[model samples]
Target: MTFLKPVLKSILLTLLIAFTASLNAQTHSKNGMVVSSDKSSSAVGAAILKKGGNAIDAAIATAFSLAVTHPSAGNIGGGGFIVFMNSEGKTTTIDFREKAPLSATNDMYLDQEGKLIDGINHFSAKAIGVPGTVAGLFLAHEKYGKLPWKDLLQPAIDQAKNGFAFNWSLYNAANYFTKEGNTNPFMDSYFRNESGGVTQPDEIWKQTELAETLIRIRDKGRDGFYKGKTAKMIASFMKKNDGIITKKDLAKYEAIERQPIKGSYKGYDIYSMPPPSSGGVALVEMMNLMELADLKTMEFNSSEHLHLVAEAMRRAFADRAEHLGDPDFNLNIPLDKLTSKEFAKKRFQGIDMTRASVSDSTKYGRLYDGENTTHLSTMDKDGNAVSLTYTLEYSFGSQMGSKELGFIFNNEMGDFNPQPGITKSNGQIGTAPNLVEPEKRMLSSMTPTIVGKNGKPYLVIGSPGGRTIINTVFQTVLNVLEFEMPVNKAIEALKIHHQWLPDQIVYEKYLLSPDTKKSLEAKGHTLKERNNMGALMGITYDPEKKIFTGASDSSQPDSGAVGY
Candidate 1:
C-alpha cells in the first residue's frame, strides 16, 4: 500500500505540470484578439477593454505602459503622429511631432570644416525635442477615451514604481547599448549594476523618477509635465547639456490636428499619417502605382511580383528623395504634383518587367529637403483606431542626458544637411529633406495606417524602422489585402525593400526564395541580404464574429497582443 501511495503522488505531480503548461500555452497563444509590441502593454490595453473603455482608451493605456516598460523604443521623451478612425466613420490625424528647439539651426551637426560629425546622438539632451507623448496621450483620451484619465495612466505609474522584470529582449538591447559607438552614458547606470554586468531576467527595475513624473501628470494633468516642475527640470537639463530646449519651448508646444492622407486599393480605403511624415504620401503613392499592375494574380514571392514591388518602391523613393519635407517649411515639395495620377503614370512607365532602373535615369522630377522622426499605432473595440509615429532622429538621441532628469535627449539636429545652399533656416532644406529649424517638426517615415473594408475599418497597423518603414507597411498591407493571408502570416511574410539611391534591394533571408533571389540577380537587381527589417503591430477585425485579431512582428522579442 505504501508503494502504491508513492506512485499515486508521482502521477499527481505529472498531472499538475501538464495542467500548468497547457494554461501557459493558452495564455500565450497567437490567436488572442489584441496584439502589441509588449505583452504587458497588451495586458494594459486588455484592462482598458475590460473596464468598458473603447479601443482608443485601450490604445492610450497600452501606449503609456509602453513608455514605461519599453523605453528603449517606446518613450515619453519623444514625439509621434496618430491616425484615428471613429465609429461614426470620421477619421482624424493627430500630429504630436517633436518640435525643433528654438536654438536649433540647419547646420548644428556640421563641424567647422562642413563635414557632418556623427555628433548627433538620439540619446542626448541636445537631441531631445519638445516631448509630445504626454500631450498626445492626453489629447486622445480627452477626445475619445471613456475611462478616467487617471485610470489610463495609473497602470503605467504602477508599473514604473513597482518595477518590471528584465527579459531576454531588454537584456539583449542593453547589451547592444554597451557597444562603443552607442552614446548615452546614463544607460550604463540604468541598465547595469555596480559590477557592469547586465541585469538578469526577473530582476526588478524601477524608474522612480519617471514614476513621479507620470504621477504628477496623472494628478495635475498635462500641465504638470509641460508647464510645471517637470518642464522646468527638462529645461534645466537641456541648458546644462548644451541643448537649446527651454521652458518656453515646452510651454509653447502644441499637438496639431491635421487631415489624414487617404488612398484606395482593392476596394479598401487606407488612412495613414500625413506630412511631416512622408509615410502616408509615399505609401499612397506606392500603392497607387502598384494598383496599375496585376499584383494579386502574381504568385506570392514570385520573381515577377518581387520585381514589380521593388520597382514601385524605387520610383516612390525617388519621389521621396526628390520632393518630400515638412510642408510648413518647404515650398518646393509639390505635394499635389507628386501624388497626382499623371506623375504616378509617368513614373510607372519606367518599370521594365525584368530589370531595375538606373537612379539618375529615373527622372523623378526635382529635389527638396530636410529632417528625422519615429511612429506607433493603436485601436480599440468601438471601431476607433489610432496609428502614431515619432522619433528623436538617431538611436539614443543627442548622446546627452539631463543628469537631473534621468533621461536622454534627441539628436534630431543631424536630420539637417550641412552642405550650404542645401538647407534653409526655417526648416526648408533642399538636399536633406529632414533639416532642423526653430519650432519646426522634422520629416519622418513613420507610417501608422488603418485600412477599411465595406466602408468600415478593418485593419489598424504601423511599424518602427527609419526609411524602411514605408516599404514594410506597404508590403504587409499587400500580403493581407492582395495575398489573402491571415494576420499573423501576413506579418510573418518576408519583407523586401529598395530605396533607389542604395541601388540595392534588401531582403530578409527568411523571405528570399533561392529561385527568386537568383532571378532578381539575373535581372540586374543588386540584392543585399539582412536578418530583419522592422517591428510591426496590428489588429484586424474578424467580421463574422465581430472580434478583433491582433498580430505583432516576430522580429521583436517582447511585442505581442492581448484581449479580454
Candidate 2:
C-alpha cells in the first residue's frame, strides 16, 4: 500500500505541473488582447485598448513601447510591414520596408576588384537605410486608429524619459555589448550608467534623447522624424561617418498601402503582406502545397508529417528566391501564379515522398536575411485585428547610430545581394532581383499575417526570424488551423526551417526524436539543430464563444499576453 501511494503522488505531481504549464502558455479575455515579446510593451498595448483604442491604436502604441523597451529589433530607424483586418473582414496591408539611400549603387558592397568586402556591407554606417517605421505607424493611425496620436506616443516617451526597470535580459545584453573587447561606442554611451558600466539589473535606465525624438514625432507627426531636428541630426551623423543617406532621402520616404495577398486554405482565408516582403508569397505557396496532403490524418511532428512540410518549404523557398522581390523594382514578379493552387499542385507533383529533393544553388537565390527582429499581435473588442513585425536587420543593427538621437541604425541594406551574379554554396546569393539600387526597397521575409474564418478574424499571428519567418508562421498556422491545437500549444510547438539554398533542414533543438531523425536521414534529408527558431506573438479568437486567446512564445523570457 505504501509503494502504491508513492507512485500515485508522482503521477499527481506530473499532472499538476502540466496543468500549470498550460495555464501559463495562454490567457483568455472576453474583450481585447495584446501579445508581444515584452511584458511592458504588451501591457502598454492593453492599456490603450482599455482606454477605448482600437486594434490599430494598440498596435501603434505597442510598436513605440517596444522601441523603448525592446530595442534590439523594435526601432524608429528600421522598417517593417503590417497586415490589418477591420471588423467587417475587409483587409489591407502596409509596406514600410526601408529603402536604399539614393546614393546606393548596385556594386556598393563590392570592392574595386568586384569582390565582396567582408563586414563592410553590414557593419558600417553605409548599411543604414532610410527608415520608414515612423511613416508606417503614422499612416496606419491616420487611416484606422481610434486614439489620438499624442496619447499613443506618450507611454513610450514616458518610459524613455522617466526610465523603466532594467531587467536581467536588458542588463545582460548591455553588459555583453559593453564588454572590453566587444564594446560598441554608441551602445556603451547610451545603454550604460554614468559610471561607465553596464546598467545593473533593476536599475532605472532612462534615455532622454530617445524621449525627445519621440516627442518630435508626437507633435509634428511624420515630419517630426523626416524634416525637423531629428532629420538634420541623422543626416549630419551619416555624412560625418562616411555614409550616403541625406536629408533628401529622409524627406522623400513614404509608406505605401499595398493590397494584401489573399489565399484560402481548407476553407479559411489567409491574408498577408505583399512584396517587398517575401513572407506572404512564400507562406501562401507553402500552405497551398500542404493543402494537397491530408495533414489532419498525419501524426503531429512525425517523420512523414515533417517530411512533407519540409519538402513544401524547400519548394516554396526556391520559388521565393527565383520570383519574388521588391514590387516597385521588379514589376514582373508572378505573384498571382506563385500563390495559386494550380501552381502549388505543379510544385507538389515534384515532391518525392521517399527522398528529399536536391537543392541546387544554381537554380535558387541565396537567403541573405538576418534573424533578429520582433513581432506583435493586437485585437480589439470591435473585432479589428493587426499583426505587425519589424526589425533592425540584426541584433542592435549596425551597432551604430547618432549618440544625440539615441537610436540604432538599421543594417537593412545588408539584405540586398552584395555581389551580383555570384551564388555561393555557403548560402550567399547574388541574385539580380535583390541587388541594391537607388531608392529601392530591399527584399525581406518578415511575415505578419491574419487568418479569417466566416468573414471574421480567426487569428492574428507573426514572428521575427528573418529567412525563417515564413516557415515559422506557416507552422503556427498549420498547428492551429490544420491540427486543431490550442492557441498556446500552437505557439510552443517545435518548428523547423528549410531555406532551399542550403538544402538542409534546421530543426529546433530536440524537436525530432532519434528515430524520427534517423527516418528523415534515411530519406536523404540533411538535418541541423538550432537552439530555437522564432519568438512568436499570436492571438486566436473563438467566434462561437466570443473569447480571445492570446499567446506569447515562452522561449522569450519577457514575452507576455495582456488583456482587458
Candidate 3:
C-alpha cells in the first residue's frame, strides 16, 4: 500500500501539470477574457475572472504572474501605466512609471568631454530607475480590486515556488543573455541551470528567491517591496554595483492616480495615460487629426490612406517630443491645446496630401525610445476593462538581475535624454523636456488605452513597442472604429509607424505592395522594412449583442486571448 501511494502521488502531479497546460489551450468565452504576451499569465487572469473577480483583479493577477513566467519584459523591477474603466463608465489611470533616483543627474550618462558614454546608459547599474511596479499594483488593488490581495498573487507565487515548464522564448532569451560574450554578469547566474547552461525546453524551472519575495509582498502588500527586506536587498545591490537607488528612494516611491488624457474620435470617447508617458497625448492628438480626414473613403492600406495616416503620425510625434514629459517636472505641457480638436485642425492644415512630411528635428524637440515591453488587456462581464503596459526597458532590462531578489532591474533611466541638447540623426535625442531630474519619471511610449461608446467600453487595447506604441494603439482603434473591422481582424491587419524623426516610414514587410512602395517613394517617403511592430493585446465589446471579442498579436509566440 505504501508503494502504491508513491505511484498515485506521481500520477496526481502529472495531472496537475496537464490541467495547467489545458488552461492555455482554451481561447474563447462569453463572460470574461484576458489577452497578454504569455500563455500562463493569460491563464491566471482568466482564472481570476472566472472566480468572479473584476477586470482590475484579473489584471493584477496577470501582471504578477507574468513577472514569474514572462521574465523578458514583465517585471517587479519595472514600472508602467494602467488605464481603467469601471462598469459605470468612470475612467482613471495609474502612473507607476519608474523615476530617476535622487542621486541621478541630467548629465550622468555623459563623459567629461560632454559626449554620451557608449552603452553606460543601457548596460550599467546607473541605468536603473527606482521601480514603481509593486507600489502601482498595490494602489490599484487597494482602490479597485474585489478579491483579497493575497489571493491575486498566489498563482504567481505558486509558479515561482513549485516551478513551471521552460519554453522556447524563455530559452532563447536565456541563451542570448548567458552567452560568453554578454556583458551582464548577473544574467548567467540567474538564468542558467546548476550545470551552467540554459534550461532546456519543457524543463521545470523554479525561482526560490523570487517566490520568497512574492510571499513578502503577499503578506505585507506594498511594504514588502518598497521597505524592509526586499528594499534592503535592492539598496544593498545598488550600493555594491554603482547603481544609484537607495532605501530612501524606494521608500519614497508612490504610484500616482491621475486623470486619464481624454479625447473623442468620431463620437467615441478615448481614455489613456497622461505625461511621463507620451503615449496617451500623442495618441489622442493623432486620433483628433485622423478624425478630420475622411479615412473611410480611402481603400485600406492604399498608398493614399497610408500617406494620410503617416502625415498625422509625423505631426503628432513631433509635438510629443517637443511638449511631452513627466507632468510634475514640466508644468507647462499645454495638455488642453494638444488634445483639442482645434489644435488638430491647425496641425492638419499643414499637411500636403501629395507628399510625405519630412521629419525635421530642428523644428520638433527630438525623438528616441526603446522596443521591449509587455502589455495585457482584461475585460470582465460586469463591464469593467483594464489596459496595462509595463516593461524592464531593453529586453531583459540591463540584462541584470539581483541574486538575492531574483528579479531584473529596469534600465529605464536610459529613456531620459542623456545629453542636454544633442539631438542626433542616429536616433539619439537630448531634449529639454525629457532631461533627467531627481525623482522625475522618464518619458515613455507605453500607450495603454480604452475606447468608450455610449457610456460603455468599446475597445480596450495597448502594446509594447517603445516608440511605435502610440501608432500601434492608434491603428488598432482606427481599424475597429473607422474601418469597422472585428477585433481579431483589426489586430491581424498590417501596421505602420513613422515617429517624426528618422523621416522614414517603418512598415511590416508585406504591408506595402511594389506599386504602393513606389508611390510612397515618389511622394518623398523613405520606406524601411521591419519584420514586425508592437505586439498588441486587445478586447472589444458589442453593446447591442452584449458580446466580448479579444485577440493577441499574431507575431507573439505563446501569446493568447484566454476567456471563460
Task: Provide TM-scores for the models.
Answer: 0.87, 0.95, 0.94
Model 2 RMSD, rounded to 1 decimal? 3.5
Q: Which residue pairs collide, candidate 3?
A: none
The lDDT of model 3 is 0.89
Instruction: Go through the candidates in order and give the C-alpha RMSD of each one to the true structure.
Output: 8.2, 3.5, 9.1
Cα lDDT for residue 135, model 1? 85
Error of 2 at 473 (Å): 0.5
Q: Model 3 off-target regions past 4 Å?
A: 1-27, 194-196, 365-368
Tens digits of per-residue lDDT, candidate 3, 97-192, equal 999999899989888899889999998999999998999999999999999999999999999999899989888887877777876678877777
User: Which pairs in model 2 have colliding backbones?
Assistant: none
Number of the candidate with higher TM-score, 2 or 3: 2
By descending TM-score, how would the candidates be arranged? Answer: 2, 3, 1
| Model 1 C-alpha lDDT per residue in residues 306-396, reported as the tens digit of each score | 8889888887877776667777788677667666667777778767987666655234433211123333445555666666655555555
Report the lDDT tens digits of candidate 2 across residue range 1-564: 988997997788668547645645788899999999899999999999999999999999999999999999989999999999999999999999999999999889888899999998899999888999999999999998889999999999999999999988888788777778865678777678766667888889998899999999999999999997999999999989999999999999999999999999999999998999999998899999889998768789989999999999988888887877788989899999988999888888888889888888886623217889999999999899999999999988888998789889899999998899998766787788899999999999999999999999999999998899999999999899988988788887879999887889999874567799999999999999998899889999998999999988777888899998
